[model samples]
Target chain A: MKILVIIPAYNEEENIVNTVTTLKEKCPDVDYVIINDCSTDRTEKICEKNGFNYISLPINLGIGGGIQTGYRYAYKNGYDVAVQFDGDGQHNAEYIHDLVKPIEAGEADMVIGSRFIEKKGFQTSSMRRAGIGVLGFVLRICGGGKITDATSGFRATSREVTKFFSANYAQDYPEPESIIAASVSGFKIKEVPVIMNDRTAGVSSISPFKSVYYMIKVTLAILIYRLVGKKWR
Target chain B: MMTDLFRMILLGGVLIYIIVIGVLMKKGKMNLKYSLVWFLTGIVLLICAAFPGIIRSFAKLIGVYSEVNVVFFLGVCFLLIIILSLTSIVSLQSERIRSLTQTQALLEKRVRDLEEKNEVH
Candidate 1:
């Protein structure tokens, strides 16, 4: 199967090289693309210097848009499966194969590499964990299946799901919202336990001040998707 | 009762608003399609100022005590509509921009790959 790993990077100069290097070393056979999201820092320069496969967006498309671009690339290149790996070094590259296995076997259309299943790795803070719990409950009520880590960015998509995302993706707070979208569209969703690390470098995208807004936005997005998401045959 | 002075002032304001919109359209700062709404708003205000009785009667029909209050109500409603339309326009533009950026990035990568291949040859 032709698999593509998409690393969406924005101002991730500190962690970009390490993330890409680890992925290359761990998954030598997998093709990867680094989406340099119009960073103000030296992310693009680093990608160019290291000869990493990267795409520099002309404008900042935010996290959701950046990942959608990756899906678009994957679809255009005829990739059978695509995996989203964070550029912040929080996601492990070793579990990529595990993430893709369900999709390859046609058991699931999307496989989320969840950190809460085994309750291993960085479990995040209590406050954030509570928020994620609430989101998980909301997803369950919305018929989005039992997603343990609703905010896990580590996920793999089958070609059909990848195409769906390329055509329609939430611009803000996409992680939880997308699961609802896929489920409503009648796509199989599964989760596998995976270990993650605390981001070693660079600041997190979600700040404390934004967390409240993030929670409300994601919850609403989930409900909205449930209401409007149409099943694709 | 609408005072003559207030009527003159309202007329002047409406004219100035229309003129400003015309200038913006001429300078290409605003699309004519978008400016049409503003123009229609200006003309409606012009009609209301020219014949204050229209607003007075409408205010009575709506059970508003004052004609000025009716004007304010209409103004608020119009502003809300314009703001909502502006937001929709922004959403459409951003979506288009995202599509364009993705296409451009993919094309750039393909060109770079072709160039690299030529170099290897």
Candidate 2:
């Protein structure tokens, strides 16, 4: 339904081509836009070499900014739905359909692919898993866990949501906030079970310290949401 | 009693806010939005503390001297409005920056497309 998949990438020289190529193989008709966020590495050059359609930010705007840019593009180009897939090949291409199913059925405005929904993947370190679990509880309290994956970047949204996010998506660690925002703004949110693979190449952008800060940030943001959210009961 | 409790909390929040904002300014992360809110909040708290009469005076104006409840309620309401207004401003400015960036991107794309069409012609 005029679907656009946005992959926000940084220094994923090893995995960008494979991720883009496989998406082409699996969802040939779907438009995939890779946002190369000022990679000092050859990530942008690789996309150019392969003739992939992409946007290269002049400065590294981070994942949040990159995804927001993608939202703006999808909104301006009149895409009906937008999916965010990681450039690291960690997200499963096959489950993309599942992620978008709720949107297609008109049941949800936002759909996130959860690795922990069924717990079907190589979960990261104990601390990180604990962090995610804590976030899940906080999200649950915020009326956020109707869907399993609160932080999964692998998600799709209907045009209503795409337009909304195109206008205002969070600029950093946005998944949780966006979920809360969508829910509060009266957009139905849901989740699909998907398996996340280990990154086939490159390092994760989030370090342990950042994950800790991220957990705290999302938790506080959720608290703020509960205090002043539209759906606060 | 309720009025006193609310006064204590309000004053404490303002004091902490000033200190935290002072630290932010020291770190060079203080923006106009932040400083403005901080300044206004500081002024409100200082005025309330320095001139405790105003709170009671407002109560008197409303025809209630012993009705200290109104004073506390007014303070809470005032603080809440300030916080909400500050957040709205920050959100609005962020939206502006995003729109400008997107416009710049589209213009760059148009120029590239025009150059390509010229080459083809």
Candidate 3:
């Protein structure tokens, strides 16, 4: 199967090289693209210097739009599957094949790599884990299946789901909202066990002050997707 | 019991508003699509200024005690509508810009790939 790994980087100069190199080393045959999301740092220069395959967006499109661009690229290139691998070092490269297996077997349309599944490797702070718990509960109530890692950026999608996301995607806080959207649209969703590393470089996109706002906004977005009811399909 | 001074001031303000809109349109500063709403608002204000009794009667029908209160309420409603429509326009434009950016980036990658192939050949 033709698989494309999309790495969306935003001011991730500290970790982008490590992330890409690890992926290249771990999965030698898998094609990857680094989406340089108008980074203010030397990220674009680094990609250009390293001769890595990358796309530099003209404007800052945030996380959702950045990943959507990757999906668009994957669709245009006729890839059978597209995997969203984080530009940060948090996500492990070895588990990529595990995430892609279900899609390759034609058993699932989307597969999320969840650290909570095995409760192993960088379990995150207790407070954030509780927040993720609440988000997962809300997602389940909204009929998004039992996704333990509702906010996990490590995931893979089948070609059909990739096409769907390229056409329609939420702009802000898209992870939880997209699961609800896909579930409502009748796409099968699954989760697999994967270990994640704590961020060795660069701060997380979500700050401590913004966690409350993020939770509220993401909850409302999930509920809104449920209420809207399969409009994208 | 409207004062003549107040009525004249209202008429003069409406006239200036219409003239400014006209000037903006002539200078191509305002798009005709968006300026239509402003023009309609100016005309309504003009009608209200030319015939004070209309507002007075409408205010009375709406059970508002003062004509001034009616004007304030209407002004707030119009502002809300206009602001909401502007927000919608911004959302549409941003979506378009996003699509354009993605397309441009993809095309650039394709061109780079083709150039590399030619150099290797």
lDDT of 2: 0.79
RMSD of 1: 1.6
**Tens digit of per-residue lDDT, candidate 3, span B9-89:** 878998998999999999999999998878888787777778889999999999998777776677677788888889999
Please name the candidate that would achieve the greatest DockQ relative to the true structure: 3
Poorly placed runs, candidate 1 (over 4 Å): none
Off by over 4 Å in 3: none
- Candidate order, lDDT descending: 1, 3, 2
Per-model root-mean-square deviation over C-alphas: 1.6, 8.5, 1.3
Model 3 C-alpha lDDT per residue in residues A26-138, reported as the tens digit of each score: 99979999999999999999999999999999899999999999999999899999999999999999999999999999999999999999999999999999999999999
Error of 1 at A232 (Å): 4.8
Candidate fnat values, all? 0.76, 0.05, 0.71
* Model 1 DockQ, alpha carbons vs. true complex: 0.76
The candidate that wins on lDDT is 1
**Best candidate, TM-score-wise?**
3
**What is the TM-score of candidate 2?**
0.72
Candidate 3 clash figure, as a count: 0
Over B1-121, each residue of candidate 2 has an lDDT whose tens digit, in order, gives 2366766776787688788888888898987655875577577665675466776677678876563466456557767877788789888877676667656655565576577689999
DockQ (model 2, Cα): 0.17
Q: Candidate 1 i-RMS (Å)?
A: 0.8
| Candidate 2, CAPRI quality class derived from DockQ | incorrect
DockQ of each: 0.76, 0.17, 0.80
